[model samples]
Target: MSSYEENYLARRPEYLCHMCGKCCRVVTTSIPYKELKKRSQKGEKGASDFLSLFEPYESIEVARKVDAAVVDNIINRLIDDGNYNEEEITFYCCKYLGDDNLCSRYHTRLTLCRHCPSSPWSIVPPGCGFEGWLFWQREQEKQKVRLLKEELIELELLKHRTSDSQMLDKIDSVQSKIRKNINLYKRYGSENW
Candidate 1:
């Protein structure tokens, strides 16, 4: 087997995705119309057009029939953190997901599809492909944060020796933003953000 296939086999103990595509049929992410227009202009019409194909849910409970536990968990977390609104809790899915579990716009599918529930660290359906990817992504992110922290320490030492207060403040602010973003990713998992 190719190294990639071999690696996947070695790491993934159970690959039970039947590709029934129920998850795809039932769940979706919504983007604002302005953002959709921008993406369409950039040749991402599938995502832009997706906004027109689905209706929004009124509540997390309504969204739950599709995947209530996952949806509730995400919504509750975001709400607790003050990052989400009640109106934004609406769930959606494309109208083009046919009875045969195929997307009419499969070729031009959005980033949501590429990193759907099956993607790493997501609360995908049971037996999805997220478990292995989540572990790998966490390890990679930890390594990245460690490296960035080291760089920030070095920059701090340099800042202490220099009298450029403005430059020092800028560097400190930037580093703080990076650390905050890293922490956000760590806390929420890459998929949720």
Candidate 2:
């Protein structure tokens, strides 16, 4: 992980949670339900662990009935990101969340549960404490990618100045690695940066 990512994990503000239970009451995954089940059957720990704790609501409307604001917040965010797909969206609720919004299995919850809002892109409820932090993390990531792109441009310039086969090969390898890092963020539109 980059230093930015390492710092993000290290500085996560778990204390900032409002304990409203909105996150536990309404949730969704990037992967659809059927794909998650397939990955679970394939012995993927993340898929199985998430499935073990969260049960899918019958439909989006059902999830809305549970918490209209949270549901609409997630839906609007997805739409704004151009990732809205009704067929792919499946809301879920954690079975361990008590009526009071506390985790009944807090002591024995899985790592997945313990790491709620794990990523900068994690879809959290409106008014979530992680909102500002996640946004900062995302900006950090974009800045990193932009720096890598600048490095790539300088590397390209170096290629024109070199005729040594060995040096050219090494530069190509470095460029490949840098490109792989940039490609990882293409879903977030890193190419534009």
Candidate 3:
């Protein structure tokens, strides 16, 4: 195993998620039913149908009350990475979450639902799969970043042998691009990337 993998493995914790369904109802992405249908037709089942059942909070603060830390973490990460604009940062919720706190469409839930709270290092909601999934994702991201950095180093060394300044400049530009991509992935949960 790579050092990164080893480090993550060493830090992995054991926790059983108690499916309180609090996270599901407290905050959701507000996708319109029409758009969801379109996505479903295109085989994007998760995105397409989610907005059909639940209503989004008129304001984000309401959603944050359910789990301020998780909501804040998601919002900050999106803002830092520039993937979400201010309007998109508004609080959202799933349509299918019933009053009983069970997903009405639990059997047909999206991939995200199946792997929710999937982080290893972070503390998760009660009955969340946070530790296992989060650990795996962090390790994967570290591996990807390590590979990109290695490639950048190799390109840098190549520049010393080539008198072509333009070629070197291009390599540098590519390296920067790669680094930015890595940073983007890091800022968001690995699933988003």
Output the number of the lDDT-best candidate.
2
TM value for model 3: 0.51
lDDT of 1 by residue, 1-193 (tens): 6563454444454444556665664453445445655787887868655666665555567768867655766666566756676554456666767777777777877655643543334545444555456667657766776777777788778888888889988888988887786676665444343
For each candidate in the order shown, give its overall lDDT on alpha carbons.
0.61, 0.90, 0.63
TM-score of 2: 0.88
Clash count, candidate 1: 1
Give the better candidate number (1 or 2) by TM-score: 2
List candidate 1 stretches off by more than 4 Å: 1-23, 28-47, 100-105, 108-112, 115-127, 158-193
User: How far in Å is the alpha carbon of 112 misplaced in model 2?
Assistant: 0.7
- Arrange candidates, best lDDT first: 2, 3, 1
**How displaced is residue 105 in candidate 3, in Å?**
3.1
How do the residues 123-166 of candidate 3 rate in per-residue lDDT, one tens digit apiece? 34444555456757667866787787788789889988898979
In candidate 3 the C-alpha lDDT for residue 106 amounts to 85
